[model samples]
Target: MRYKLGWASRFGVALLMGILTFSLVVTTAPTQIQGAIAQATAAARQQQREQQVRQVRPETYDLSRYPVTDANERHWRNVLWTTGVVEPQEPYVAEAIAQIVSLTARSGLSRPQQRTVEMAMQIATQLYFSNPTGYAAIGQQFLQTVERSPNPEWSAMALSALVKTGLDPQQRQRLGDRLRQRFPQWNQDIYLFTTLRDLALLQQTPTTPPLGDLLKWTIAPNQVHLYVICRPDRGVLCQTVVKDGNGQFLRENGQLWSIPLLLRSLHELSWNFTRGQTPQGIYRIEGVRPANMETFRAYGAYDLVKLFAPYEEGVREFVPGRPGQLPATLTAYQALLPPSWRNYFPIQQSYWAGKAGRGLFRIHGSGEDPGFFTNNNRYPKSLGWNPAIGCLSALELYDDTGRLQQADMPPILNALTRLGGRSFTGYLTVVEVPGADTPVSIAEIEAAINS
Candidate 1:
């Protein structure tokens, strides 16, 4: 039985083998097709994601404005970035970093000049997000370089860089201790106070507000008291807070003025001193002129809080016009001052140059009529974003409807009124610190949060 059917059975075996091979091919075809489709879908999704990243990337700053030949212009721009006046976009950051690196390889800059470059490097690195490790290394090197010198400016800048890099506490503490021991001869309390705050922050200890305390420490000995710290460069949009005698915040009746402030205009700069820029120091709010008053009405301000005349009282005059003028009144004023106070000007003039004016500066309502379109002028829009004469710090009252509201008036009025109505006693103390020739970065804010 076994021998007779062998050749015929071999044909059946071959047919069965062919059927199994066909079935295997049929099963695997769908798997191969599915894999191809999945690969195509993934590739399409990856392209979409890349497009999204490209579309949403931040715009680069215009580098042509900072030509390499113009060191003053470039340095000024660097100051702006360091102080948060102008935030450095990625391109600016990279450009600054490259400049610093190149400058480091060569030598010949003066100490102050070198400090400026180092400061710019600190600012650029802190703002940059892409190269944290590289930035940190540069910051460390900067710290070492500055530590060798006794210059507090360099020390302060280096400390700022360390703060921004989020240096570890133990290392930060050691550096801070060294800074404290090294720089007692430094005159500016800003350096000491700022470094103190940085040290406290690093060690996880309590820190007094650097600017607030610095202001308090400076003015504490003087007879004039401060009721509010009007920092037009703080908080959301901009925060100016009112403080009490103890330096505690006064929240009553909207004492906190959280509104945009207008700075300076080109036309105004021609005639008016301070160049329409907000002054950087403390000034006593000696008196107030009401809106009904003819003098202020001519100048187009609402309620006027007269800061202590940086010059002799009634000596400097405001020359009124479309493009206003300020006369050289300091010479006359110096004659009237007692010999002691007369010398004070020479010592304090640098600080008071911006603070002093020809006597028309005021925080007031916008000149534009709220309801009517007598003109197409936007007072607040111009003022808040930097367009005012030397005297005007215009408040924003315009609502989303383009109509001005009285809401802006209450906070300023309330603080002034509560202090003594038209006879408020303390300095107006308008500070936009760490900027506009005074350099402070928002990294201070970040350190505060970490603390």
Candidate 2:
């Protein structure tokens, strides 16, 4: 049986013990426990050797001052909640105000606890969107701590959290300036991706457009935005761009993959239920789905994916009935549909007239099996290209062992959710540019980035 890491308890007490024990082993060990003594001695020697070899401090931080507050009850609760401690009574989301107040008291924190504190701040940021003035003091305190910390892990978490605190433009500029100095070079790190996004937004100088022609479609002018640019011929090289309400680019041209299937043309939405041709044109994301039984049955785990619609241009609205109660004409089409595609609900419905065989199209993970969508061995190995029926493309991140898994998607999904908010209800325009049959060139992507 494949061992699935339980999210709620994945990094719980056991992890804390391991961290604490690792710290203890660095200092002392009893000679009675022969095996543990040998291990500890060797680990201590290795740590000493590493420390001597480099002036840079070790990656780990001191968490002794963590759970950073006087109120022990609320501190542990927020910590457990942040760390995914799954207990029935200990719900994930308590009152946002309580979490914010609890976090305010604490000062010195390790990288791990800083991350927890960041999560708490995020809850407050999302909750108090209308009135973020209440969090000004908390944001400043957290910002000062992050600014003082030299550890990259802690600084990265703190800086990113500071952005979400809804700090004023001056504060955002200060954070951005600090980030630019720290992360001078750019790789595919998502944290840096978000940092760059906030930097651009804070600057807000009406700079050059990031996504080029894709910007034309995303002109709705909303607080949250997602631009999915599909290059069907390029397969895995689709680009997902995110922006704040003021049209400032946040995440510029991040890598995202899609179903490897190619469309017959730019206009084709889908051919069948299973072998879907990615539809072109604009679609609005009306719903965000969490993992459920149906999802688990289909993908081996409950993964989050946004449901988009007007499956194709002018093709909106299901037949006037419930899921199974399709009209006679629709029923005929449903009989020919694949089992997986049947009974899919619309996140966004349209009342337009001309309707063809277009239904569910979502941006989802690669599921439990990396090659599950492509029959385990039938597809290309490029993340640039994967298989999707008629759905917009998505990615399931690689695990620590470098294997793709469904569970790895949560972090990236959370990033998207953070950009769009908890509900993530917003405009999602999917633009497909045709005639470029070759895989998306690196030059083209770089141009998008620099633009």
Top candidate (TM-score)? 1
lDDT of candidate 2 over 1-451, digit per residue (tens): 1112332143233233323333222222233223223322334335533443332111211134333444444554444332221111111223333344344345666555555554454333322322235544434545654555444433444555555445677777777677557656532443444345535645553332234544533334454556555454434345455566666555324432112222221111122112224444434454455544234313322244554343333222222122322233434433322333223211111101113334556665433223222222222423322344455444333333332222323443454566666655555544454336443443564465455
State the displacement of the C-alpha of residue 15, model 2, in Å, after optimal TM-score superposition. 19
**Candidate 1: where is the Cα deviation over 4 Å?**
1-92, 95-98, 101-150, 177-194, 201-283, 287-451
Per-residue lDDT of model 1, residues 80-116, tens digit only: 3332222323444454444553444345666555655
Alpha-carbon TM-score of each model against the true structure: 0.39, 0.37
Q: What is the alpha-carbon RMSD of candidate 1 to the true structure?
A: 26.7
User: lDDT of each structure?
Assistant: 0.40, 0.39
Candidate 2 local Cα displacement, residue 202, angstroms: 45
C-alpha lDDT of candidate 1 relative to the true structure: 0.40
